[model samples]
Target: MESLKNLKVGVIGLAKSGLAAANFARSSGASVFVTESKQRAECAVFLKRLAKGVTAEFGAHSDRILESDIIVRSPGVPNNLRVLVQAKRSGIPVYSEIEFASRYISPREIIAITGTNGKTTTTSLVSDIFKTAGRKTVTAGNIGSPLADCVKKITPRTSVVLEVSSYQLEDVERFRPTISAILNITPDHIEHHKTMRGYIDAKARVFENQKKTDFCVLNYDDKKVRALKSLCGAKVIFFSAQRRLASGVFYSNGSIVVKLPFAGYSIALKLKIPGRHNIENALAAAAIAAAAGIKRGAIEKAINGFRGVEHRIEFTAAINGVEYINDSKATNVDSTLVALKAFEKPVWLILGGRDKGAPYRPLGSQIKKKVKAILLIGEAAAKIRKEFSGTAELLDAGDIDGALSLASRRAVKGDIVLLSPACASFDQFDNYEHRGRYFKNAVLKMKKRFEKK
Candidate 1:
């Protein structure tokens, strides 16, 4: 519902969010220009989608971003860029794509979910619950599509389930959700946010614009997340996997249960995914669904039918009595720690990639006790070897393929060769999925190689 007749909007980065924001702005009657740091040839295919009112500038001559009334930044782009600062100095605002898209959601509800991990699984679960409750739901943000791309599809009956990240929340001015949840807060994105406080502040912005009428679901087990209650203006509902909550969802002796503020009895739901972390995710999803007025039966049905997202401790193949697990989505120290707990075996763990400023020293205890040997790859290999060389047998395999082959050879019967690289994938592959696919392919290829022998 934002008026956009004569305004000129500059979209930073020629990525998916950038293209979607440009297209949306143009469709809303604004003159749009896209600025990408890459060369024109690098973005030739994406530029083909530009229409009459939209212009694109690629590479080198990119200070043109400051000429617009507002700047919409892509998720991974840093906010401290020279052009962004210059624009800020000139009184032009820089906002995330989610912030821009939220302005267009008039009558529909948005269930925005954020945290260090489990955002994707919890968001997908909530979306499925809404769909099972017979509501039109669209999944976006860090999960399905960019928030800007999902904007036009919003109707009065449609609800958006967004998996928001700290990067997206950093520059949000009015990106408030009707029902927001922070599943948990752990050490993540320190490379981008610079410090712990900066990261916490960014994640807390998801509920900054909420009113007393809105609802915010929080993780009761996470002290940092539980401490955010006073900061949120919305009615806070807590979800815990360890203890019984008098007013929210939790896990008891053997089942998932929930107790509403007024209910005399609690309801226990079924879960299809394993792992304690996933159970917490299910509980968090249930809290969000219940706060949004989704039926308890619908919630139980969605949780029962929900399978987990790919690349997070996903089984690739079993080769010669050895199991290869792909946890390519484990991009931080805490996530990798959770993945290690899922197995009770002699693990040949693969750990490396673009280091996110997380210390590998904290993971040494788990690696020493569980992992038989560790293969290091990507940019963080040396750093990981430094921290874990004393804890386990360390092998610098240099890259993913080399690491997988080395682990495959070392792995014996009942061994787990797990790829839980506690770092970002940009160091080697296009993204986490690409890295996960490569790991799976290598595992299958190794299996085939052994079959012929």
Candidate 2:
């Protein structure tokens, strides 16, 4: 294991991960050069700030990228990019941010969670469970802080709960987690992954390097995940909301029940989080916690007290007898379906953003059954509208403000104004969190306006 000292590295893309990689490279005594797509002016400005230690070029692939000893690619950059292809041809090693970060970190147990949906929630829940069980745990990776930044803080006993993306997993070599969970694989990141099989394969790599002692918690409800039970080398434990599992965790008689092979008895517990998806997430968290030898009592306590992460079914201000809910974190059709199923009240559903290539038919059907009216926003609005034309009352609001105003106006007593956009937020907002915060602020302002009236 060589330190990154004086290593000549090429960082492709000037995105957040690229910037983090650049900073990490400088801190580790490595010289870095950044490259970006020709059209991005923001990348040019970012390059100017790094004028002293880093160099940048646009449009055509720079020959200098091939000169580097190693190339650290941002998550957005594909492996098949011309520069990356050239690097491989020149025998220059290429790695993702996660791979680069993993090389520098000391060996510690990692609990990596990856899927099309519920990765964030499951990662947060698992981290909470570890904390409740009295373990030094920190949630990082794709969720918030880069794994490189948190790696130094981890002790041998510290549990690293990582929210890994398929992009991060794509280039990993020796990266292995003690507990790897693939929540549910759905069609997402299709633009990058190209095919559903590729996406599934990328997610499955979370468990690819796990040893026999390592645990792989899978979603038994998902056909794709259940099919991998025979392929994975790690000890397989399943969690499902729809079916009762013989050994692992399942929902039984309105309570979460965990039946482990060694325990000989089933532990029935209550959950604070609503929805079957959340129940599945809780079961996955509990499975991981129990595998790590955490007490059943502690696991039960954590699941019951866990209020869930913000921006996922987060209740905003109630104004004039109308309740506003922000589920901006539901960035996929499957996630929005779960959110819709959780609420029984007639919903004024605010939906749409940058499409992730998921089929909108199922969501349309769910909307037909669950939502009263649909408020459309962002680039995918028209597509969603077309899908749900006669299924539900579809209204195009064009933007978040317009959508919110319309939903607020249409919402009546006992009706829910829900912002659970079933697409990526990159079109109208910075990210899902930004979208969620804006929705909350708008709801608060509306509440204030009604109070003044």
Query: Which one is best on lDDT?
Result: 1
CA lDDT, every model vs. true structure: 0.86, 0.83
lDDT by residue (tens digit), candidate 1, 41-124: 978767887656788877753677788988898888886888888888898988899998888876469899999988888898
Evaluate residue 292 in candidate 2 and report its C-alpha lDDT on the 0 to 100 scale.
Answer: 77
Off-target runs (Cα >4 Å) in candidate 2 are 38-61, 264-268
Clashes of 1: 0
Error of 2 at 442 (Å): 1.5
Error of 2 at 125 (Å): 1.0
Which residue pairs clash in candidate 2? Answer: none
Model 1 poorest ten-residue lDDT run:
262-271
For model 1, state the Cα shift of residue 117 in Å. 0.8
| Per-residue lDDT over 117-186 for candidate 2, one digit per residue giving the tens place of the 0 to 100 score | 8888888888888898888887888888877666567777777889999999998888888888888888
